[model samples]
Structure formats: C-alpha cells, structure tokens
Target: MRIRKDYMGFAFLLFLAAANHWLLIPGQVLAEGSETFYPYLLNTALVILLPCYAWEIWRSRGRNDAPLFWEPGLADLGRILCLLGGIWLWADAMKHLGFILPTAFFLALCGWLYGEKSVRKLALLALVSPFVLYALFTMLGAALPQGGIEIWLSPLLVR
Candidate 1:
C-alpha cells in the first residue's frame, strides 16, 4: 500500500519521540528517587510536539488542499541545492557571526523562496525572529539549538 506522506511524517515523529524517551529513561529518574530536569524537559518537548502533529494529521486526513510535500519537479533541485549550500555556509559561519544574523538571513531567504516579496515584511521577520528566540530562551529557560554562535554572541548579549 502507498502510504500517505502525512502518515510517514507522523511515523517519523513518533520514532524520534520514542528514541528521545529511550535515551532519557535512565537519566530522568535516579535509583535514590532524585530527578534530572534536562531529560524531563527533553521528553516533555518530544511528547508535546506529537499531539500538534497528530491534530494536523486528523485535520488533513480527507482534504485535497495544497500539496503536503513540496515536490518541485525536475529543475526544483536548484532550491534543494541552495538550501543545503546555505545551511553549510550558515554552519561554517556560526562560530563567527552567532545565531541572530545567520538565522535572519536564512529566514528571509526562505521567505523569498516561498514567494514572499515585501521588503518591510522580510525586514521585520529577520529582525523580530531572533529576538523572539532570545526572549524564549532567556525568560522560559528554553533549551535553544545552537551551533557555535553562542561562543561569540553570548558575551555581548548576556552577562
């Protein structure tokens, strides 16, 4: 049977959730009844994202709206190439520039890719997105993903 793409994504997400929980099982609870916060947080995030995904799967089960997966035809490989190349460059530059600059560029470029064409909108997105991340990490103590950006940016942004 040809499986629906949404099902495949859901399965992949479930597998990741399982893997995350398995990896953290030994750490979250101690034999002496102490608890580690890191694993608990990780497992919580994994579990949390699943329901949103499940809700999407339920909502989209019957509708033929836009394509679930963007299949860009033959010449569409160019976008893939650009995407990978940009990611590579972003990784290489992370140590020097930090997350904010590169992430802004990446976000704006992606918006452009999806046909967004307003300079004001792009500027706003590129600026506001990073601050939103910083706020989330600072206020909520959320574990934000980083490559090497923190090495340079942290000293300037945080005490």
Candidate 2:
C-alpha cells in the first residue's frame, strides 16, 4: 500500500511529540505536587490520542473520493509565512514592550490580514483581548514578561 502524502505532516508532528516527551520534558525538574501533573497528563494524552489519530488516518486512506490535502496557493503560503513572522515578532516585542501592546497590535494585524473588514470590531478585539488574557494568566499564577504597562497595571491588580 502506498503511503499518503498527509502522513508526512503527521509523522513530523509525531516525531516532535516523541522528542518533547523523551528529550525535553524529562529534563525539567518539577516542584512538589501539582507542578508535575500537567506534563504527565499531556504525555498520557499524547500516548493515547496520537495512535488513535494514526489509526483513523490509516482507515481513511482507502477513500479516494475526498482530497487529503488542500494545495495552498502562493497568496495563502505568503499569508501563512507572514503570520508566522508576526508571531515571532510579537514574542520578541512582548519581552521589551510587554504583553498588552504587542498582543493588541498582533491581533489587529492578524484580523486585518485574514480579511476582517470591520475596523471597529477589529479595534475592540485588539484592545480588549490582551488585557483579558493578561488577567487570565495573572489569575492562573503564570508569570508573564513585564514591561511598562504590566509594571504599572500589576500594582493595581494586586495578585
């Protein structure tokens, strides 16, 4: 039987998952109780789900009626690359400019790039989402990289 072209992407992701499970996560020394829980849970889920996904894909391989992969046009490829670059830039900018501003700008830019025509909705989403995420992260006890806005606003939030 011929291997499906879609399997290539799945293989790559499976390899990454394996590497993450074996090489990376094992090296991190966790704290006492709950800190180790998520990694173990993720590993278990990956172990179970990946094989199920592979099985489903294998079972579906006989059906030639539907296309397995969508061939993206050049414009789609360019937009995907731009989105990736934007994510990298946003991550870097968050270190220096803080989470809110960079996240807001990235959200707006992504919305515009992906063909959201309503300027007011885009503006509102761009403005509101970052703060909401920041608050969520803060409440969850995840320490985020801080800059001017975070520095100022953190005092007011008071844990």
Best by lDDT: 2
Off by over 4 Å in 1: 1-43, 64-70, 139-159
Can you write out model 1's per-residue Cα lDDT over 36-148, one digit (the tens) per residue? 46556867897899899888888876687722664446555677688778878875665566667788898888787757899999999988997677555544443333446
- Candidate 2 residue runs with Cα over 4 Å from true position: 1-69
lDDT of each candidate versus the true structure: 0.67, 0.76
| Candidate 1: residue 50 Cα off by (Å) | 2.4
lDDT tens per residue, model 2, 1-159:
344556765786788678767774565323212244455566678777778878877787769752356456789779989999998999799879988999999999899888999999999999999999888656655456688999898876764
Give the winner by TM-score.
Answer: 2
- In terms of lDDT, the poorest run of 10 residues in model 1 is 27-36
